[model samples]
Target: MGDYDDDTAFLGQTGPYFWTTFFLLNTVFVSTGFNGFYIVFIGASPEHRCLIPEVNLTAAWREAIIPVMSADGRQALSQCRRYKLDVIRNLSEQGLAPGRDVNLTGLEQEGCLDGWSYSKDIYQANIVTEWDLVCDDQWKVPFASSTLFVGYLLGSLISGQLSDRFGRKKIVFISLAAQCVSTIWQSFSQSWRMFCITFLFVGASQISLYISAFVLGTEMFTKTLRVVFTTLGAFLFYCIGYMMLPWIAYGIREWRTLLAVLSATTVVYIPLWWFIPESPRWLITQGRMAEAEAIVRDAARRNGVETPLVIFRRPELQTLHPGKTYTMLDVLRSKNLRCITLMCLVLWMAINVGYFGLSLNTSNLSGNPFMNCFLSAIIEVPAYVMSTWLLKKCARRTLLSTFLVIGGGVLLLIQFIPAHLEYVALALEMAGKFGFTMAFSIVYIYTAEIYPTVLRNVGMGMCSSAARIGSITAPYVIYLGTYDKVLPYILMGSLTIASSVVNFFLPETLNRDLPETLDQMQECQGLCSGPKKKKCVENGGSGHPAKQHEAKSDTA
Candidate 1:
C-alpha cells in the first residue's frame, strides 16, 4: 500500500487549521454519547401503582386496595394488580376499619384496568408514565431500546457505503440535521409507537453522523494523529458527552424537556460545516485531484508551510482500486480470514452485551439512578486511558481476555454481595464497567490489526453488525431484572467470561505488521503443531510462510 503520509507531509502534523478541524470533528462524539443512551432516562420506569380514584374510604382501606407482593425476598406494593375495586369499595363503605377486620390477600385481584398512578419524586414524566407502559405493557420499555438498536443495525449497514459514495462531510452534516430534527420530533410523540418510530430515526442519524465523523478524522489526520484520534481523542470526547448525560437529565426530570434540550445543543454544530474540510484522501480516491490538491494547499497555507506546485504523487493515485471490491463473502472464503472474522464477531458481540447491558441497566442498580449512570459513564475515562497506554505494551489477545474476565468476574461477584451493602454492589458494577470499557477499546484496534487491509472495513462492518445484534439483545437482558434482580448480572457475566475463554483461541496482534493481503494474514497458532508454533514465534508471530518471509525481509 502506498503511504499518503509522505504525500501530505508538507501540510505539517499540527497547526491552527488541524487543531480547529480536530476539535470540531471530535465534538460530534459528545452528541453521539449524549443521545445514544438518553433512552435510559427517557423511558425510565418510576415508582408507580394502580390508580384508585378518589372514593369515600379510610386511609388504611385505601392502602389495602393495592396488594403486597413478594419480590427478591422483600415485600413491596404490586405495580400491576389490585384488589377488585368493587369489593374494596364495598368493604370500605361497610365500616370495616382495620387490616385485622379483613384478610386483604383473600380479596380477588385484577389488573390496573382503570389506569396507573406514577410517583413524581424521581421523574415528573417519562414514556412509562405518559403512555402507561407498566405491568402487562412493561415489555415495551426494553423493546423501545431494541427499536433504537434496530436503527443502529440499519444505519451501520449503509453509513460506510453512503460516505464512500457521497463525501464524508456531507454525511456528517446531513446526519446531524436529521438527528436534531428527529430528536425534537420524538419529544412531541403522543404515543409509544410514534416515539419508537421517531427514535429509530434518531438512532439511524446519530450513528451515521458518528461513523462519518470518525472516518473523516481518520482520513484527514497523519499517521501519529490518526492513532491518537482513534485511540484516545475521540473516545474521551465521547466519554465527556456520556458524563454530561446524567447531569443534564438530573436537572430536567421530564423526558420531553430533556429531549428538547439535547436537540437544542446540536444547533451549534451547524456552523462547523464551514470549518471542517472534506477528506483529501477520499477526494484523491474519487479522481478529483484538483479538489484534493486545493484542500492540501489550503492546509499548508494555514500551517505556514511551503508546498511544491505539484502535491499528490502519481503512485498515490495508482493506489486507488476503483474497480476492485471485497465483500463479507470474500472474508469468509479464506480459512485464516474466516477464523479471525468469526472470533472478532463473538468478541465484539460479547463486549457490546457487557458494555451496553451495564449501561442501560444503571437505572435498575441500588442507588440514585442519576449517580449510577454518571458513574457508569465516568468510569470509561480511566478505562480508555489505560487501554491506550497498554496498546503498545501488551499483547492484544492477552490484554483483551484479561479485561473481559476481570469485568465478567466482578459482575458475577456482585450477586454474592449482601443486599444491605448496596454501595459495594454499585462499586463492583463500576469496576465491571471499567473492565469492559477497556476491552471495548482494545477490540477495535485488535480487530483492525487482525484483518488484512483490503477486508478491514468489511470485517469491521460485520463485527459492528454483530455488536448491534448484541446491543439489540441487551435491553431484554435488563428486562430479565424483573424476574430476578441478579439475573441480568448472571447472564451478562457468564457470556462475558465465556467470550474471554474464546479470546485465547485467536492469535495475538501486538507489534505485528498489519497484514496487507490474504496470503499475509496471521493464522491461529493457538492449536498449531509444535514446529509451526516455533516458526510462528521466530517470525514475529505469523503462522503463514508469506507472512514469515515478509517479517524476515523487514527484519533484514
Candidate 2:
C-alpha cells in the first residue's frame, strides 16, 4: 500500500465510528449468550432454576415458611411446613401478581410440605425443598466454562490466522453469524448435554468475534487514534451489557427463552451486511485494487474529503503468489517478533486470571448478585475512561506496570477481610476491578502496537489465545483453591505482579508510528545501522537496502 494523507488517515479514525455503533449493539444483547451464569443456575440456592423445569420439591423441607409481611405479625404461610409461592401476572399489566393481589393459598402445589430457611434478618424467610436439593450433576456446570474457553482458545488461534488469509471483514461477519446460529440452536437445546455442546460451538465462534472485532477496529482507524478507538470500542461491552441483562433476564426467565432472544439479536447485525465497509488495509494487502478504491472513495465522500483513487491502486511490492501460505515459522524468526508474542501471551493470561477470577469473587460481595455484577461492571466505565486518559500520557511500560501493582495490591487485601463483610469487599473488589480494567485495555493496545505490520494479526492471535487459555483454567483453579477462600485471589494477584516484571523488557511505544516493515522494526529496537540510509526517511518506509546502505556508510 502507498502512503495515505491526512484525509485518508482521518478515514481510518472514522472506521471506529462505524464499529462503535454496531459493537455496542452486539454487546447489548448478543454477548450475554455466553456466560458462566450456569454457575448460579446449578450451584445457586434451589430457589433459582436452571431451565424451565418446575422442580418437584413436595417431599422436601419440614420447617414453617414465614411471611415477611402480615396483617397480624410476621406469620407462617403454610401448615407447619414449607409452601411454594408462584407469582402470576398479566404480561401486559403490573401490580397484579398472584400472592400479592389475589389468593394464592388455594393455588399452592399439592404435597406442599417443605422447609423455609430464615433470612439473616428475622423479618423474612425463603422456602426451599425440605430435603436437600441434590446438585451432583449441577456441580459440573463450572467445567462448562473450561470447555467454552477451550473453544475460544482454538477459535482465536484459527480466526486470527484466518483473518490474514481470508480478510478481516469476512471473518467478523462469519463469527457473528456463527454466534447467532449457535445461540439460536441453544434456544432449542433439549437437555444439558445438548446445551453444553451447542454452547461449546458458540464459544468457538466468540473468540473469533473478539479477534476480528479488534482487528477491524484497528485496521479502520489511523495510527493516531488507533488505541483510543479500540479501547473505547471495548468499553461498549460493559456499557450496554450491564444495563440490558437484568431487564432481559427478568422478562425472559427461562434459559432457553433468553438464548433465543439473544440469538435474534443477530438480525440487527444483518444490516451491516450492507453498510459495513470492507477493511481498507485488508483490501490493499490482498491487492484488490478496484474494491479498495471504492471503499476509500466512500469514506472520503462521507467525510467530505478527497482521497485520490490512485492511492488505493495496487503498489508493486512482494505480493503473495496464489495460495501462498503464511506459516507460524515466519512469526518465530524475528527476535523482536518473538518478544512481542511472549508479551501478548503473558499479558493475556494475567488479565484473564485477574479479570474473570475477580468477577467470580465479586458475586459474594452483596446480597443481590445482579446488583453486585451490575454495580461493579458499571464502575468499569470509569476504568475505561481512566485507561484512555493514561494511554495518552503514560509510557506503555509505566501504565501497565502501575496498574499491575495497584490491582495486585488491592486483590491481595481481599484476603484479610472477613467473608461476610460484603460492603468492604465491594470497595476492595472495585479497586481491583479498576486496576485490571485499565490493564486489560492497555494490553489490547500494547500488543497491536508492538508487533510489526506483517505479523500483527498472528501476534494478536497468540495473545488472544493466551487469554482464552487463562480463562479456561481460571475456573478450575478457583474451584480447587476454594479449600481456602483467599487462595485464588492471592494467586491471581501474584500473576499480575509477574506481568509487571515482564513489562520492563518490552520497549516503550509512545509516539512511535506503527512499524510497517522488517527494517523499521529493527530501527525500533535501536539497531538502525547508519546515518546515510536515513536519507530515505522522507520516502516513508522501505526494505533492507535502505537500511543496509546505512551500515555500509558507517564503515567509511
Candidate 3:
C-alpha cells in the first residue's frame, strides 16, 4: 500500500483548520478528567465514630462512651466500636461516674450497632456518610472505585473495535452523551449498589470518549503536532479539569449536588460535533477517498491554499483494502508484535498503578483533602510540559525508565521521613506524583509509536485494559492505609521500581518514523543478536521490513 502520510502532507502543519480541530478534540479530555476522579470526593470517608443516643447518660459519660484507640503513635476515638450502651446506662443509674467511679476501659465494648456519626468539617455528605460505609463496610468504598475501573476495562476493550468500525467522530459523541447520562444517573442513585451500577456505565463512557478522541487526534495531526497534542494539548486540558474538580467539590460539599453539576457541564460539548471532523486518515484507510479528499480540501480552503485537482493519488487508492480489518488477535499472532504488545501491556499497567494509586490516595494524605487532590492534579501540568520538552531531547525508553525510577524511589523515601514532618511528607508525595505524571504522559506517546497504524487503536485499547487492572487494584492499595498509613506508598513504590527495570527491555522509538504496517515495526535491537542489532543500527533502528514480514509469517 502507498503511504497515507505522503498523500495528506499538503494539509500543512499549522493552519486555522488545524488549530480548530486540535482544540475541539482536546477539550474532550477536560470532561474525562472531571468524571475520572469523581469517585474520590463522592466516596470520601470522613472522620466518624459510633452514634450514641443522648438520652439518660451524663455529658461526661456520653463523651467517654466512644473508645479511644492508638494508631500511628497517636490516640484517636474508635470509629467502629463503643462502650456498651446498656452497661453505661446501668453504671450511670447506679450513681457511678466514668473513669472516677467505674473504670471505663474495663467495661464491655461492642461494634457501632446503633450506626455511626460522621464529622462534617471536610464533607457534609458523601457515600461514606450517607450509607455508613465505614468499619466493616469500608471495603465497599474501594470496591465502588474498582467497579468504575471494571467498566473502564470493558470500555477500553470495546471502544477500539467500535471506533474502528463506526468511525471515531461517531463514537466520541456517543460516549460523551453516555458519560453525561451515566454520571447524572449516578448522582440520583438511592443506594450504594445502585450508585456503583451507574458508576460502571460512567467509567465505560468516560474512557470510551477519552480513547476515541485520543486516537482521532493521533490520526488527524501531523507527526510534530502529535507530540504537542498528546503531551501538552490533551494532558494539560485534562489536568485543568482535574484541578477544577476539588475546587468544585469544595464549594459543593454534598456529593449528589457536586456530581449533578459536573455531569451537567458536559452538555456544552455536544455542539462540538459540527466543529470537529472525522479523521481523514481513518477515512482513507476505509477506502472512502472522496470523503477524505473533501476534508482535506476544506482544510486547505480554510488555510487559504490551493489543493491539486486530485488530492489522493490514484495508485494509492488501488492498494487500499476497505474490506480488510484487523483485530487484537492480529497483534498476538505475530511473535515480535506479541512481545511488543506484552511488554506494552505490562508497562501501561505499572504506569497506571503508580499514576492512579498516587492520585486516588490523595484523600488519605496528611493535608486538606481538597488541597491534596488539587496539588496532585496541578503537578501534572508541569509534568506534561516537561515531558513535551524532553520527548524531543531524550530517548523514549530511557526517559520512561528514569521517570518511573524517580517516582518510585521518592515514594519509597517517604517511609524514612519523620511523622511530625507532615508537610515534608506532602512535598515528597507531590514530587513522586510529578515523576509518575511525566511517565504517564510519555507512555501514551511511546506505546502509540510502537504499534503500527492499522493496529494502533487495538493495541492501545489492549494496553488500556491492562491499565484498568492496575487502576482497579489502586483503590485497594490505598485501602491498605487503613492498617498502616505508609503501606500504600511502599507497595506502589516497589511496583513502580520493578516496572522501570522492565522498561529497559523494550525498543527505543525516538526520532523514528511512525510504522504504518507490521512489516515496518521496530524490534528490540538492544536485546537481539549482534547481526540483527547491526542490521537495526544500519536501518537507524527501524527493523528491516522484509525480516519483519518473515518473522510474522514464521510466528504465524
Candidate with maximal TM-score: 3
Compared with the true structure, all predictions reach lDDT values of 0.81, 0.61, 0.86
* TM-score to true structure, per model: 0.90, 0.75, 0.95
Better of 1 and 2 by TM-score: 1
For residues 1-556, could you state the per-residue lDDT of candidate 1 as single tens digits? 2245556777777887788788888888899988989999878889999998888878988888889998878899999999998888888899886478887767899999889999998899899998998888999999999989888877877776677677789999999999999999999998999999998999888878877787678668765465567668778899999999999999999999999999999989988888899987667666678898888888988899988978876553454554345566787676666776777889989999999999998888776899989989989998888888888677788999999999999989998998888889888989999999999888877776676545555666678778889999999998988887788899999999999988887877665565545544667755532344566676666544535665555444
**Residue-by-residue lDDT tens digits, candidate 3, 279-330:** 8877876878889889988998998888989877755345446646778879
Rank order (by lDDT, best first): 3, 1, 2
Clashing pairs in 3: none
Candidate structures ordered by TM-score, highest first = 3, 1, 2
lDDT of 1: 0.81
Off by over 4 Å in 2: 1-138, 312-325, 522-556
Return whichever of 1 and 3 wins on TM-score: 3
The parts of candidate 3 lying over 4 Å away from their true place are 314-320, 526-536, 543-556
Task: Return the lDDT, model 2, position 117.
Answer: 34
lDDT over C-alpha atoms for residue 551 of model 2:
31
Cα lDDT tens digits for candidate 2, 461-495 = 88888898788878766765435667888888888
lDDT of 2 at 442: 88
| lDDT accuracy of residue 103 in candidate 1 | 78
Which numbered prediction scores highest in lDDT against the true structure?
3
